[model samples]
Target: MESLRNLPLLDQLKDQSISTLVQTSLIALIGVLLLVKLVQRLRLNLPPGPLPLPIVGNWLQFKEGLNPRNLAELANKYGDVCMLQMGQRKVLVISSPEMAKEVLQTQGVEFGSRARNLVFDMTTGKGSDMVFADYGEHWRKMRRIATIPFFTNKVVQQSRRGWEEEVDLALNDIKEMPGSTTSGVMVNFRLQLMMYNIVYRMMFSRKFSGLHDPLYVKLMTLNLENNRLAQSFKYNYGDYVPSLKPFLKGYLKEVWETNQRRLSFLRDEFLNERKRQTGEKIGVDFFLEAAAKGEISETNVLYLIQNMNVAAIETTLWSSEWGIAELINNPQIQDKIRNELDRVLGKGVPVTEPDIANLPYLQAMVKEILRMHMVIPMLVPHMNLQATKLGKYDIPAGCRVLVNAWGIANNPKYWEKPEVFNPDRFLKEKIEPTGNDFRFIPFGSGRRSCPGSLIALPILGIVLGRIMQRFELLPPPGVDKVDLRSVGGQLSLVLASKPRVVLKPRQI
Candidate 1:
């Protein structure tokens, strides 16, 4: 009878223990919720954005990823400075010129560091090159080295003849193409070759024989693949969501493989060859000397070469391609360019670098194209090294900062009829693309602005001016106008199709 009574007591004890456990769990859960609310209260001053879901955080809304169009849409709703929680990462999109000035110039030091994602990290070798490196002593040294040999006024003066000669060579090749005059010729390859030769000669004292040259084709293929992989929006999700990273193994592998191939080709074919020669200073010679002096590693020198190959060649090519296509689409613009060239340089005289200053219309046209179709819509992203206040909101340290150069340049408040491509707007106004006028920062502004702008501007004028001076760029037979539809990437705005134009030799 005593044992049976003890069993009931034991059962009561077990029930009491179960009740206590449930109470403890409920208390802990409530405490966690309160702590989370407190943390949210602390961050309540963060810029306005759509509420984000746990783990995903605004990612589900971006099916195409965080492209300019989507970001612009968000800016329209959220205001000039909107914060986005992309998974765990915080992105601050600056869409107004005033905010851009604040981020890129006013507190530039606080927001001067480069934002490195997985793809860029791989390509830049963890911020080793000048263009993608963080703002610091190493970056300063690289920038100093790059500016001296390749981007300075002295370098431009010395290389002008070679650049012009490359253009002339390309023109000669176009003339030799079968049915080039009547059936229309695709000058894209020739133009790409000309750009390659111009940069390659400066860097390696070398140039490919033609567009079809095995080495040229290989290099172009590799670089195009590299750019495609690096600039793809597909790779961004993995960077934003750590859990999604395992899915990007194949993509990351391809990027790494492509980078390795590019490095090997550059090292074996160019850098190593330059190492064998001892003579007057070329671009690589400076880098080689820097490596020899223990100022920078040989790996850095190779990356510098990689940067020049992509940055120097690809960007200029896109601009030239866009400029020429725009001229073809607008015959009136072409006539204006031709008339200016003839009046400025005289009939049949080619456009020289120094002559560019006298051609205000040409300069305006360059500005217009850069403004109308910014090659890099979201200029290489910037990051704040420490927590800082931007306008009314608090920006967390290490937040990725993107200035929508496209949105700013195209904002109606800043420019009248911003969508229209009228170079006359630039002619009437004194806005310049040298990052002075924040409304027109195609090459960006501040310490991280493209140093190659000095070279790019002159090249654009020379190439377009010469072509207009020599040939009438017209659309293919029976085609009303070249398709002006552009495909936008995270980093570039390229034409949907390669333009083919009939180059009728002008009787200049």
Candidate 2:
């Protein structure tokens, strides 16, 4: 009986060993199959480009800088559709106008989505804001709600008086400066404030006195910091190789903390002020009313405000600064625009929004400025939801697409004498900035294009017109020419040197 029991136990132990070996063999077979599939997927017909290193691919090429010009240099070497391996992420750089239209227009829907990164997610409240949100139903809903107030011509008409009033205040301030008429004054700082106030008034039906005001200072400081952090290359390591994100854990924590503080201030201070008001709403208040009705959440409303606050101020301000700098550098262009203004609105009379129609030369000059100094050079990167084909090669899913607006605009093939600043190019061509003409898309094209152009254009027109009408802008005494160096590592093409100008009040 004892011998029989030992035989049974020995048989059970042999069965257990056989079962364990079979399971191990099956797992190894499945792993090999999956590895084969991954290799096949990686061997897809990608575009022509440089060979990637072990982990950090093509990143060494950008050791100097990764500005628009630098990216353009890469395009010059590679073809129109060049692929660069940026760590684990693949970047498709569209160079030619034909390729740009294909991505931004023809196959727009296939590549319409926005790429979400760590910094953008934090600044925009995790893709809650309309501008940076991925293309989807939620993006459509937010856009529809946000655009209701600013969609019609009536909106611009209603806001005209406010714009004129602000420009008048800006002009008066320039005149009040002691010896500003003879001795030039730094205009960028003042114009930047005026631009901020105009946007503020349009949003909340109120305005801040100047940058010195506590609230204005706080808001400005926060917004600038957010932009700096969001656009900084140092913070973009994880965007390429996400596996290395653990190294930036501390920095990510700080950004999250800063964003939280910003969101709190936006909700408690700015949004709360709007909520306290009791009246029939207008402007952005229209959207706020919808939020109150539970149509949209308060959190979304705050994010929308944050987007508009930065968008409305920075784009126009930087463009205006560049416009003024260009005019100061080329006095002939200034003379021509003033001549057109004199012919249409006449000197000493306040330039109105509607008056822009009669002033074609002024309009052309604005277009030229936009073409030369693009406000948002890269125009916010786009992404593909699924694998798609552009021309000969196939693009993998989730690839980041950068439309090189600066590259296309300045390409010698597209424009003759592209380096020189000449408004006549626009006068003869008559290309609208509406993105319809792929050759010149300063405001971008397609569904993701900036809707703020309706207000931005008119404000730019009236503000620039009034300034030229009232003041003869000249470079500072010692400065022979206005400096046009660009600010590095920024979303917008900001001027490096804030040009100081002698605002000699024009005689009627």
Candidate 3:
């Protein structure tokens, strides 16, 4: 009997199997409980966020959005600091000025590193552009050298006249536009012409021509249409699912491939231009001029040229469009701005740098538009290099941080009546930072903030101002309210590139 007992009593086979099943079930239940506890414990120290399911965190909340009004809404609910999920990438979004100040200002270095994602790296030839490069000696060199020629006050002065000159051309084109009504049609000519010309002239030393040319078409395609498309793909699998990326099943892969091909072709053209200028007296093109500075490499020069085209053109154009849309929507804003312009420039003169100082209301309008629609909100997902503490929280090494400039700029906590389009918020009064407590500078702050702000704003102010000065902007017949919404899937929040008209020439 003792031997049988030790030997499982000659094996009551069915009963033994039942016992095993019970044990297995109990183990699985305990394991699940332990996993839940473990996960909760691990995430406890992280910032507040919506409850996350395994494998997919808060990704379902905000799709790979160009403009995440959803995220801002979450800030209203979950407090200013929220955590977003993009596959394995962890995004920490700071939606209030307090958090923004902590991340963007007092604790900038802790959150100052740039993202090391595969797509961004591949797009930038592994971040050859100064804007996207990782923080290190090479990045420093890129920032110091490339920024010198491109962003210097001297460069600002040089480009200012060029911007005015090209704007004058756009004005001339608008004036000469043949039409029976005499009022200029509300068209996105700025998309095809002026905005592209400003960046093109600065980069390649001539106005961008050849509408049917692949370069022109590529630049043309890069406008509002592309902004929506790109934003769509960011939240899709091609950007995240490793296995699915190679064998993509959606339009995203095709779109990416086509654009990648265009980028390659454009890069070759840019490089060939540089190669041709190898020993020649390094001409006026920004790429060549920067390469002459010794620290900035030829590859970096090409990168700068490409970025100057893509970066300067896209952001400036889209932002100007928003200012236009805002002006159209808020005629009072436009009327006030136009009154200032009329006072400063009188009639029949295109807006130049001289006219900018006198137009504070216009400046405020631009700032307000930037605040409401932070074109590249989150300001390109800064990274963490060294381990540091953000207030009481311990921000681990290699953590990626996003300063939610969109919410910070528009939070009622930071701005009075965050929803309404009021430029006066930026005018005076010290308010809590949606991040840093400086006057509402939409360009960003610190060493890694956009090196192009000084250039970008004036381009916006001038383009918008001149458009108002030269032509009277009114919504086209049957088009009321200037209702414009973004087409999704871009990484930036630019208006969907539909043509909106302001009655030019005759109507005013």
Candidate 4:
């Protein structure tokens, strides 16, 4: 009886000992993990940022949205080279010109690759296009092919007359509008059409008849929807957090559907028609030839067209709209432009591509507009292909690096009264939009700088010069100035309100 009771006691003691051992082991494992994490953090000199919470990281801070203005506020708090833990993704926001120079130019090769997200992957066909493709041989090939026909000086020479003709047509249409002189007309749609025609003609060798052309309307509507969907931050939670990916099933499906529709439209309407008809080699022909030779895929060609449709057309249109609005807001600036035009290119002659070089003030205005209102404020987020050091902080490979072009351009440290819409600033300093000076990189610098700048700058000058030459743009009656409020997008900043202005025919 004594031995049986002792056996039971011994069994109970054995069970308690095993439980104690298990608890002690668990505690020790947890301690080791915490120590390892602490040591790893101490080893890496990471940039300063707001403390990230568990799992979600700094996502809750961005409940409103991720835009240039919001990023600017962050810069104001955390210095120029600050880190933002956006869920699992590491984002380094560069605000100052010095840091921008380092990331964009000095370390261009290191930071040349693009940061791909779920939405961009779907839209860009998994890096089939140049804009979103990783910086490598494939991107090199696409860039070379795109530059040959669309962005070269020779293309500008060949296409200048056509561009001028389009401008004249636009001007004539505005002049014919009822009450165009007395009451202001909303010319936003007309301008949008003109921009589309310019790019479409270059890409497809075709132009829509007018704003009401069924094809034009369909294409514009699709592009608008595509931009809205692609540029939204709502569907990006899944991108930051892998666990949340299931929630994006419906959203991703919609994006897929929209992309399919867009691709089909491009193929059936434009690419297929081009295939049927043989003509003098045009922009599409260049890509087709490349595809035929196995240089790229047919799908790549379609993605290229998509890029031209969205990137080339929309950004230029936004810049032009902002430029015109500024002119309407400041009449003296208009008079100054008119005087410059008269002095430089004769009284009534329209500005030609070659003439843009001579018109200093007009070029200044273009530069100023680009500086004040950068269409692509963040300049397409860059990625480091390998681990790199940005200033004193260690930037891990695959971190999404953003050069806040808007913040840099508007930073008072670099610019005096950075908020003012003054063209004289450019005249005071020889800051071209060529991205040579880090302070005013309207088009980003280094290897990935916008190839379209060669064509875009001249186009802007000609359009603005031609319009100002023909008509005196004025704000609508009872309005002192056009509303210059802007709404930010994922990649672009656009005028919040469509500007309405009266065009008084100038008798030169």
> How would you encode candidate 3's per-residue C-alpha lDDT over 143-236 as one tens digit per residue?
7665665677677777789888887776666555554124335445644477777766665554665345666666556433434454455535
lDDT of 2 by residue, 1-508 (tens): 8989799789999999999989998888766755754574478778777766545667667644356787788888888888887777788888888888999889988888887677788778777888888888878888888787765588788878888888888878878877686768777777878887887777777788875989888887887777777767886667677888899888788778877778889788767887788775756787777787877788888888887876778889888899989888888888888888887766667779988988888888888888899878878888999999999888999988888888788888899898999989987887888988887887778888888888888888888888888878888887889899988663667888887788887878
lDDT of each: 0.88, 0.81, 0.65, 0.89
**Model 1 error, position 115 (Å):** 0.7
What TM-score, computed on C-alpha atoms, does each candidate reach? 0.92, 0.90, 0.82, 0.92
Which pairs of residues collide in model 1?
none
Residues 1-508, candidate 1: write the lDDT tens digits: 8999799899999999999999999888767755764587476678888877666678778757666777888899999999888877888899988889988999888988999899989988999998889899999999988889998999999999999999999988987898778888888888999999999999988999987899999999988898899878897779898889999999999999999999899889889988898878999899988899999998999899988986798889989988988998899999999999888789998999999999999999998999887888889899998888887788889999989998889888899998877899988989989887898899999899999899999999999999899898889899978987888776788877888888899885
Error of 3 at 193 (Å): 2.3
lDDT of 1: 0.88
In model 1, state the lDDT of residue 134. 88
How much is 163 displaced in model 1, in angstroms?
0.4
In angstroms, the error of model 1 at 427 is: 1.1
Taking all chains together, the TM-score of candidate 1 against the true structure is 0.92
Pairwise TM-score winner, candidates 2 and 4: 4
Clashes of each: 0, 0, 14, 0
Q: Mind giving the per-residue lDDT tens digits that candidate 4 earns over 1-508?
A: 8898799889999999999999999888767755754575689998888877555668889855577788888998999989888878889899988999999999999999999889889999988998999999999999998989899889999888888888888889988888789878988788889888888888889999999999999998898888998888786679888889999999999998999899999999999999999869899899998999999999999999988886778888899999999999989999999999999889998899999889999999999999999999999889998998888898888999989998889988989998988999888878887888999888899998989898788889989999999999998889899999998767888999998889999998
- Model 2 per-residue lDDT at 402: 83
Candidate that beats the other on TM-score, 1 or 3, i.e. the better one:
1
